[model samples]
Target chain A: MNLALVFDLLLALMLLWSAWRALAAPNATRAVVMFIVFGLFLTLAWGRLDAPDIALAEAAIGAGLTGALLLDAVRTLGESAGADAGGARSPWRWPVLAFSPLLAVILVVAVLEAPQQLVDLPAVVERNMGLSGVTHPVTAVLLNFRGYDTLLEVAVLLAALFGLLALAQGAASAATRESFLLHTLARLATPPMIVVAGYLLWAGAHQPGGAFQAAAVLAAAAVLLHLAGLLPAWVAPGRLLRLGLAGGLLVFLAVAILPLAHAPLLTYPPAWAGALILLVETALTVSLGLVLAGLFLFLSGRSLRDEETR
Target chain B: MRVAPVLRRTLAFALLWWVLVEGSSVSWGIGLASVGLATFASLRLWPPAHWRISYAGVAAFAGWFLLESAKGAVQVAALAFQRRPDLAPRIIEISLALPAGAATVLIVNVLNLLPGTMCTDVEGKILRVHVLDGRLPVVEEVRAAEARIARMLGVTQ
Candidate 1:
């Protein structure tokens, strides 16, 4: 039919193919690689659904960071789902195959039955958006209307960081030397990446990007550096690292509770709403970056210890 | 010559913020605060005195690298479209004259990006690259790529 329909069909087919292959791929590396592709296709599908925000998150967090994590895990573990995994089939394949058709029918029915139009939320957000912090309706909803949800989302990231730290038991010596290629690329890329992260964070106020996307990009760069032996996790100072990791949740909680004078939680004064949200987003971005990067560090088979002789 | 990498980074961060905020100076205060904190954290983790890059060398290397990679992409794309593709893929190990530094790292990555070649591993001065066309003199190509990077980085043997 139309271009969009063709694009959606292609995306759906690719998603299905990749998902199937990612599950049944011969080796761990191939499986994880296909899984990454699957996630990327899912991101595109999200875009097709007209959810730019979800699409961005899916691309950065779902596809990008998750791929890096899986790759790192495979590297560290030195294998994937199975030993001598080639041509291995899942034990429950027959049962899964039998149920898949029914599940697909149910899913198709649900999709067909679901309402195509939302309940004028965008119109409402547009009208009262002046009082809300930012220009973007998504940002307004996240930072102003459903601020609690965003706060909890950030807290979950912080908690994950702590969980990773608690689980990692050993620390290896930091690699001081980086290869010429990695060192130069990291050097040049760092400047542009910094700029991009900043731009993404700022643009989230009026567009698709937000703290989560910016933080994910930052974390990816950190992972790349870590992998290259350019910036090891062990070099981070304990107190400062702890503070940066928890800073988002702390700032959000503080900001949330401070506005008791206002009618509702996180309802900032219209004049200062934009500035306040910006401050919170900045904190969230930093903490999320550190937390996500910390998780990658843990996955790298090196626990970030409190003290290290850098 | 002396350099303050930290300060330079902080200034770069400011420029980044300027572009991020769409050239608006209204949020300079927030920008300054965030830049200070990020710069401090970045400096502590990645201190100065690590890298000293030559702008001209980097510029020249970028130009050449871009051209080479484009050529490589075209070659690979053409191969993909062919009815009968010669995929004599095999891994080859070569020694890098440039030490295990920036030049070597870039060479490995660039080689990985190049058409029909993938650098699987790099240890010290030795690099293991897998090429699609094993018949081709990929070793020479890799060696030449390394030499070009070495010249750019001024990493003398």
Candidate 2:
């Protein structure tokens, strides 16, 4: 009845519509665009849920990075492949169609039957906030309470990059696309981007940003420079590159292990907690930036080996 | 490579850092290092172009650009509701007097931002612009925009 409820309903509808369109779109490029639109809608939904941190991550990583990767994939895979894939009707289609509604019903019933709140997690987090060093609950949870999960996340990202590197047969350097306007813009934008990244990292201690968000912004700057034909695509990891790629995980693991010498894993001294978190975050920002940008760079360039093999 | 330019760029970057961090004195240590790195990176990426910019001219252009964009948006919106819209879509190529650099970039963006006209491609000194209504004097408008930008950047005729 109220305007807010109406707006929320409209947003939900739009999200569903966009997701459906993304799946059903005929052209591969159009489908990718639709998927990006869906990601934006999902970001808005996260914001509506009052989860600004999730919204930022969703917008930057889910929508921006994923969309760029998908667009690049489309380009590399060619339009014909997308067309064939889109037009083809798989054998499992009928079975999936029949099973989807049953699954949805089961999920809805499960949600409806579940206990509302067996534990007051927020209250618990609030009570122990003083010990976490970080002022923000989300930051505390991510960096202190559940740091092992973040460690695994960085390791997973590293493993993924390693897999990408193994599969990559591209040259160390290639001809960069040139644009006068873009080149100038890239130069102008890079400084501000760096400042923003630094600010985001600093704010993470008491705000909605952290290493992941800062890393994404830093990666975006590199992507912009690459797109503008300023920065070159990466090939195999050299000594410096290797250090940059693995530095965050190394720093994080070292921090985790240091506590193991006395305390349990990943437990910093009460006095050094804030400084250690900042250190870990700084390392994560640099390493993850390289990794995220590597995800794009490795996939984009033509392989020199392809010609030799051919 | 000049000390004056390097210092100027560093100060600009420092101001930006201060603004971004909301004048947090605690961040100055990292902020100073970041500003230095940004200045160094910028110097490498962007070569000295001997640009002489007029702040007053930039202000004037910005004001005019905002007004034009608003008017253009309204006009385009009105066109959408017309019973029988008369749309003449065509691409017009024009040779620009301004050399390819910041000024050219500015004009290209200005053309793209304004409603009814979009810059599709720029090949050397020639710019290809797509216009919603071919009847509109897109060529003259682009030329006018180019002139204004040239003035703003203090580009020589």
Candidate 3:
């Protein structure tokens, strides 16, 4: 086989290997590390498949944010014990093992046989590019063609944050020991990060970036500031904080509903489609950034007593 | 004047925007706005400091850093290959001459990147370093590196 094919094969094998390692790791922390590795491999696979948008999201959200959350979870859960002491004793193991191979075979057959039966979805999106506000097909699909999905995604995120806040029971752990190195880094790097986030937001109209990616970068900057002890974790949502947390969905819904008086939901008039999409995406970026960062920051203040009570 | 840092940082952010946007003329409108916002944020995050970095000094320090890193890597490789390697790992606390800002941070990070010495902790002016071999003039090397960083940042002894 050629080098590209060999590389793809290697990537697939690594993905499987890492997935197994993450699932079968002896302890929680190692499993989280392997899970991060798997997410990274998945990003690479997406890149190989020529989906830069998916790759960026996977790297930023899947590998980076998810890994951070899981690591914090492991620490909070205090599950340093080996697998035998934890989840290995689940009763469903045998039935799951017995059915897994058959399911895998069925999935393989379905995947192999599906190409002829399925519509060329990308071509369909390409045909509607002129009507969709953005030039990028993925952006067009995410914000215009499938606006409902993004709205729901943001709603789910807001709900998740609300749940986190409810579960949180204390103020921020005594101001993290100030690390001068981190402070310096946060100072130097934050401006560039913000600029990059803006660029991503702007680039979404014609390229492989959009609100989600921009928001993820912004959240990363916030996390860096917290780690550097420049910004404290949230004690409670204030007026402005609440506005930022829910502003995106509110804006999206307003825009989505504005057209409903004359037409179907989210159907932006062709003349204002580009501007409307940009406005919605900008609002989404800010709100989503806060929500994503809140996911971590809210949990930062959580008390062990809450865990005990649970 | 009071406005110098603002102007300089805004200009820097503008240049950064140009580079990030790859000189796209159409993108400059948003770029200008972003540069302004970023500049404002940066100023708030870190107010003006007296430190002025010298590019010539930076280039010199970078070269020295590269050379030291190469040498350190080779030494570490040799140690790894040797059976029953003569090892004397030690943690030594050394007083830092550089001030509490960027120079100290730079040296601390640089030491971590270097092969043998690791800056494990920094408390006020004291730096706790862990070196793989204590006999390798670790203290002197750290001082030299710190001196280089201080020079680069235009900091005086």
After TM-score superposition, the amount by which residue B79's alpha carbon in candidate 2 deviates from its true location, in angstroms, is: 2.5
- lDDT tens string, model 3, A224-246? 78777878888889999999999
Instruction: Report the Cα lDDT for residue A258, model 3.
Output: 96
Which candidate gets the maximum lDDT versus the true structure? Answer: 3
TM-score, every prediction: 0.76, 0.92, 0.91
**Interface Cα RMSD, each model:** 3.7, 1.4, 1.1
DockQ of 3: 0.71
TM-score on B-chain, cand. 2: 0.90
Candidate 2, which segments miss by more than 4 Å at Cα?
A80-89, A170-173, A302-310, B134-137
**Top-TM-score candidate index:** 2
List ranges where model 3 is wrong by over 4 Å: A80-88, A115-118, A306-310, B70-90, B132-135
Model 1 iRMSD vs. native: 3.7
Query: Which lDDT tens digits does candidate 2 get at residues B9-78?
Result: 8899999888877777775766776788788888887766687888999999999999889978987888
- Candidate 2 docking classification: medium
Clashing residue pairs in candidate 3 (N, C-alpha, C atoms within 3 angstroms): none
- For model 2, residues A1-310, the per-residue Cα lDDT tens digits are 7999999999999999998888778878988898899999999999999998888878878754787788877766666556844434688877888999999999999999998898899999999888888898899999898999999999999999999888876564463777777788888888788877877888889889889988998888887887788777776679999999999999999999998878999988878888899899999999999999899877765545445566
Q: Regarding lDDT, does 1 or 2 come out ahead?
A: 2
> Which structure is stronger by TM-score: 1 or 3?
3
- What value does the lDDT take at residue B69 in candidate 2? 97
